[model samples]
Target: MSCDGDQHTMQSSDDVLPPPGDIQVLLLTLDSVSLSWSSPQGLIGPQTFRVTWGCDGETSSTRVKDVHHLKISSLKPGEKYQFNVATEGEDGRQSRWVSASLSTVLPAPDQLTVDSVDTTSAAVSWNQSPGLDHTQHHYQISYRCSGTEPHITTTSSPSITLCDLKPATEYSVTVCTVLENGKQSQLVLTTFTTVLPAPDQLTVDSVDTTSAAVSWSQPPGLNQTQHHYHYQISYQCPGTKPHITTTSSHSISLSDLQCGTQYSVTVCTVLENGKQSQLVSTTLTTGSCPEGWRRFGCSCYYLSTEEKSWEESRQDCLERGADLVIINSEEEQTFINGFEPDSYAWIGLTDSVTEGTWKWVDGTPLTTPRYWWSGEPGGGTYQNCGEIYYISSGQGVWRDYDCTFSQQWICEK
Candidate 1:
């Protein structure tokens, strides 16, 4: 009976299977792991392997046959786990368990947001990932403009400020958590557009009686060709409505402006989304005549306040860089006549060079339609210079006079 019992015990021992060997982690990710092992040497008959994994007081197990690898998924990130593998024979006999331990990669930072944005920079922040050693981990940040190459950087803090970004342009940013072991989490992406930049170097290139030409340069470090925004120009005089216009070009001409007026001009950049930049401003004054001068048909006329001889009056006009008024049309004669009614003034007309032959100061011969009095120039050789005098009928006419006569005169530019 003892010999029979010993044989049975030896048979039972031979039937028992040995555990798998060299269990190793083949792959590890934030949420899964793949494991592989070598089968026990030469003792398995229709046997299956039992894989068990546990984390944070929770355990799960599964069985596999004829396979040297097992993949465990749906696992929590940044958590340490314990795994065990054992061999099971067809007769329900099992071997000792092989144990291994590993930790998953850290999770991605959560709630990524853009705290503030400006023309050339932006501030970004995120919440720290749970269950991580803050001092042992860092974040990798990448950013780029639309359709452009990306820039990469790293930060140990949960927030970072990105600088030198383009204005009014779309940009994408990616943030990822990196552990001291060189493991990284999945990338988290976000996008934002910078505010438009204000135009600079505002200039009023030229100003005329009724119009102005203005130009400006785009802001520095901005790519004008890539941006489609326009410039808004507003010009206004005190107590008047503003004149506003938009243009894609760097220069514009404002027409129908008031002459001799000072205008406040302002320019700003406007994005397609209707966002506007700060305004750049300048001031310009339109063409105007000098004080104490009267404007008429693009010319300025000054009437002398005192009287003098014809030669002396001509000298006075010469000192002022002007010449005696030469009436060229009926309207001009009428304007002068009505300016100082019934007053005698020395005109530029003269016949002193040749009696019976009249000419103007510019050496032009007097033509018909002249404002000569009915019987003017009757003085013949006695009267040499000409003057304008009003008749009792209230009509202004020209008369020959002596060169030594004293009277007021008109100066024209």
Candidate 2:
């Protein structure tokens, strides 16, 4: 609005100072207002511009010696205020006050909502801020992972989609309302938690009759968030109770299962929140074992390292839930020969009951097609025990020895 620079009320002084003109208010905000006015025309030298303002029934004045404009601050937001400006000439003459009225900025956005949270992204929305202007209205969005610095963005649509989040994560979000007048409302704050991801890509690395090794990877979006991960592995035979195993590593070897049996295996990832991800399952067959015995081919063998007499060795093998070695085929004879090279080991053959009638330890009689050396059993009834002789020939051959001789033996279970 225009104020008269030369126009003034009647004054008796010879040097009459002109009144300030063209008073205007610009750059108003929630807390402060700026005021500018032209200098009075009649002033001869530098003039002191006086700015006086009053609001809520209290008045305060400030004087600047040479500047035509004064910026007033520290006013309450969303409050009404009145301001007045005047010019005091260098001669001590003062002009009447030119006044302007203003109302401060609007209140902050309300009802902040953070929703649709997942491993890597979330959605944010809010209500419009309460204020006098909406022409340039917008919401300033600021969000950060819990315990970290924040990032900011501006949007006029009142809603935003957050990105680059992590699984099982917490975030703090703030929304502020701004109007065309550049006045921002108080910030609205809230927190949100992202959902845990589902573990996938389960693999059974290897499997044996009684044990299996399984491996898996954590679900997507959980790499940075899950500093400590847990794996839950469950396996079961068709009719048995499930065996559960827990470990921090992604790979686990499960044991104590039935051999040659099909088993169902599942792996799940455990989040820091103690929530388990979706289960990934696979099937494998475990290898077989015979109590403490190891199997090869169609039979299981338990080699004994202790030295004992022929009879004592026989009894010891039987006590250990097995039988002494019995050569039934040429291949079997050759295998036994290589098993104990450069040494003699007792076999389950003897003619203890009858001098010329050979018999297996299991009561089977030796027939004419035999695996024996021509000169064996020369001691007649006294050489009644049979042993594998390996030192005298290129390949081992069976020979009858005294039953009192001590040697190492092999047991078949």
Reference-based lDDT, residue 90, model 1: 76
Alpha carbon lDDT of each predicted model: 0.80, 0.73
lDDT of 1 by residue, 1-413 (tens): 01110111111223267888978999998678999999887864665887778776667777788998988887766668888877877775767778899988778999999999988999999998765643378999999986889999999999999999888778999999887766788899999988877888998887655678899998655665776688899999999999899999899999877777899999999877788888999999876555766766645577888888888888888787567778888877777776673368887888888887888888898896588888877676768888877554434889888878788887765
TM-score of each: 0.50, 0.44
Candidate 2 CA-lDDT value: 0.73
Q: What are the per-model numbers of colliding residue pairs? A: 0, 4
Residues 226-272, candidate 2, lDDT per residue (tens digit)? 44678788889887889887887778888776767899988887756
